[model samples]
Target: MSLKSERRGIHVDQSELLCKKGCGYYGNSAWQGYCSKCWREEYQKARQKQIQEDWELAERLQREEEAAAYGSTAQAPPGAQPLTFSKFEEKKTNEKSRKVTTVKKFFGASRPGAKKVLGGKRRGDAPEAKSGSPSISRQVSLETDRVSKDFVEFLKPFQKPGQDLYKQCKIFLEHMHHKRELSIEEQSEYAQDFYQSVAEKLQTRWKVSPEKVEKAMDQVEKYVMTRLYKYVFCPETTEDEKKDLAVQRRIRALHWVTPQMLCVPVNEEIPEVSDVVVKAITDIIEMDSKRVPREKLCCVTSCSKHIFTAIRTSKEEPASADDFLPTLIYIVLKGNPPRLQSNLQYITRFCNPSRLMSGEDGYYFTNLCCAVAFIEKLDAQSLNLSQEEFDRYMSGQSGPSSSTSSSSLLPRGRESSCPEGSALALVRHNLEAVGQLSRRQERVEREARRLERDLIEWTEGLGREVRGLVQRCPLRLHPGTPASGTPAAPAVAIDSDNLEDPRLPPPLQPQVYAG
Candidate 1:
């Protein structure tokens, strides 16, 4: 055949002119020269079918593996939609970025600075720093049982069995105090609002019921009333205020007394504390008066004395020294002393040893004995100097009877106010002779003189400290304004003293209690 005819004609025997697989199909005369129409169709169909089957089998295996791992074939909800930018879109974005990176790598391979210019990570995938606030997981941990233990420990002293409601009550009171300065009437209104808020907080934050919150608040109020009755000066309500006309009473009693405004409670007798505790407390007062702020020192000293008196005369013994010690220290460290002085003075009538001793079944006798012993001990300790030195000290000091500005703050009036004919005055005179050692008739006079000197000198020193403290931290009732540098006590108007019953008998002798 001619060469041109041979190129165009089919050659059956020549494999090069036929399909490469020799499938009895004519070759296409293309680059691979593999197969012709019919045979190429069958071959393509078989390969495509295999590929399709492989893809199906892989998908089936993936589903089975997922079901095995999760123990269920979880599916999206009926109306659930896919995310706007899903993994499929992300995959396309990643592939396109890779292609761009590959092309850039080839083009920039010769340039040393190109690597430095390129981003280390894809911009969209870069990590961001977390915010400064604590995570939700951490926030949730505060309300857990782990934190309850700490709350319980704090409120243990104030808690009743199976409940620590007083902690919540304290929160309410403290919030009111800290919510900016409010006037007396304003404070009352704010306190009522805060009280309600505390109830809600207990119900929500503490998981307490509304009923429990109300009950706890009531208990807290009663406890507060009891405390105000004994310690708070210028309390919101009192027997004296109650006796006034309703309109006047509301106006006067609108004031809110804070925990810091401790006073000897009205119409309440001083409760007795232990002699040991009283002695220790007094020692602290004497030693730290200068180191502690004048206001705190005075308030704590006053509180300690009041507690001592209360423990000495109260029919019931204090729960424990521990119960009062922490609280006492806190008051000493933080109490407002100026307000405390007013409180002490207001209850002077109830604090008379003579009255307590004569009152039916009162423990005033035991109280007086303890107090006398304490005073004697203190007096003996004070007389450590030579007789001449003691005499010199005595000569320079004024007696408690003197009402000089320096000695005015002392609680001396309570003793001196006893009538001349009263047994209380006689007892005082005898107690004044306690430290004497009588030798002969003349020696007795000398001993009495020494005892008197010692008593006067020691008391004078104490009065001086009190006066200094008051000067440094002036009480609210002081007439003149405090010095520019001095810390001023919180101010409240002093109500006029309620007159005592005219027929009431004079306090019996403190000496009678000693007997």
Candidate 2:
């Protein structure tokens, strides 16, 4: 059975997934739901419109500045007529008429005798006069322009070699552009060969060192690829886009797969772990936004770092490939990044071979590809679930059992049916509850300690007060002993004499009553 047939009942809105332009191509969120071609067209049109508006604005501002300056320096010429609104309007109209006439003459120069009438020289044939103000083209800005300028400055001393290199690259690009028969692979091979030849020339012909040659090659790649991105990336001749759509559909269908199912140790309940996981997801999704292979590779590395951080946060140990790969797969499933296949293919086909063959970027990119592959071929055995269970989940008849606890975490009336949502809700709710309980426990312990301290302080104070009172008025063990440190006098022999003086009548009365 086909893979599509196995993933039955996984429904996605066709309109939502397809290009908004109705071009029968898959859409990407990075392009605002348009295919790459449509996106590029829209972007160019918008940019052109913006440039026109900016030019008009700048012209208006310059005119206003000039007018203000003239007004500030107000002093009519000695013989000049007094200016009036009517005269100003008439003068403006006359100037506009003169401009119209000039334009007509310039355009009509193609006609016979028109050039002779305009001094026998076409405007195109004459050298353009340098102006104090910058040209419209110069006013237009691009990020790559700065890089190009820096490169030019770097090549200033080697003008001949630079021009040769530029001419070669331009010719090569033009040839590739016109040669419609060349396949994408053949074009890529040609590009690679050209790059290698250029590097050799920089070293052998120009005597550039190997280290500088690498930098120069980087600049060259950037210059070439920037111009060729639209042509080379997801070209109509390739099935990379179709593979992208397939992977997207598959990932959407498998949205129910959870960390538990994948054995990915991502505990979103921990704040640190959750943040790292989110960063990783963001990095993966942002890969589509970058146009360069190096930039996309950097995104992969960033995502890998985040994944490792998440694993460390959850497991409290160093993460290995065994831990890293499953987590990456889980991240991919969660992120469902747009144009996954096309981006990977672009990087593989065009990225500097040396950069991809070695280094941390290469390793992370390979793991990412493996993760994507694992996801594409995922089945019951891959997830360690029974075939019947997998089918039920795929058909939307069942969800992962691990998500059941997540239901209780949802709000009373606002439960999510999506397994991923349920799982995240569970983590968020459990984390909040744990945090609350932890705070309460801490408060209780704090209050207990405070009460214990107060009791100890009160007991100590009471003991001190009692000791002070004892010291101030010492208790006499015997009536003969004094509080002062003095020797006790001899005890009196007739204690009855002292007692009988006050109690003699009482004793006689008690004896008569007892008898």
Q: Write the residue-wise lDDT of candidate 2 on 224-324 in tens digits.
A: 67656656788665667778999999999998887656667667888988888899999999999876677788899999999999988888988766677
Cα distance off (Å), candidate 2, residue 91: 78
List the global CA lDDT of all models: 0.37, 0.68
Error of 1 at 478 (Å): 99
Residue pairs in collision within model 2: none
Off by over 4 Å in 2: 1-141, 144-147, 153-164, 203-210, 403-515
Among these predicted structures, which one has the highest TM-score?
2
lDDT of 1 by residue, 1-515 (tens): 00111122211223333445665543332213333233335545655666676566556655545554344324556575543335444544555445323222221223222222134322212232221235633543343334345445544643453254655545654665453233222333344444455556667767766556545554444333222222232323223223223323222221221111222111122323344345444543443232112223233345455555444444355433322332343233232222322332232211221122222211212222222222222221232334554344345442222222122232445445756544446555556555343335678788899999999999999999999976754444545456786776544334222124353354343232454
**lDDT, candidate 1, residue 300?**
38
TM-score of each model, paired residue for residue: 0.18, 0.54
How much is 346 displaced in model 2, in angstroms?
A: 1.2
Of candidate 2, the 10-residue stretch with the lowest lDDT total is 1-10
User: Could you report the Cα RMSD, in angstroms, for every candidate shown?
Assistant: 44.0, 25.4
Give the CA lDDT, 0 to 100, for residue 302 in model 2.
96
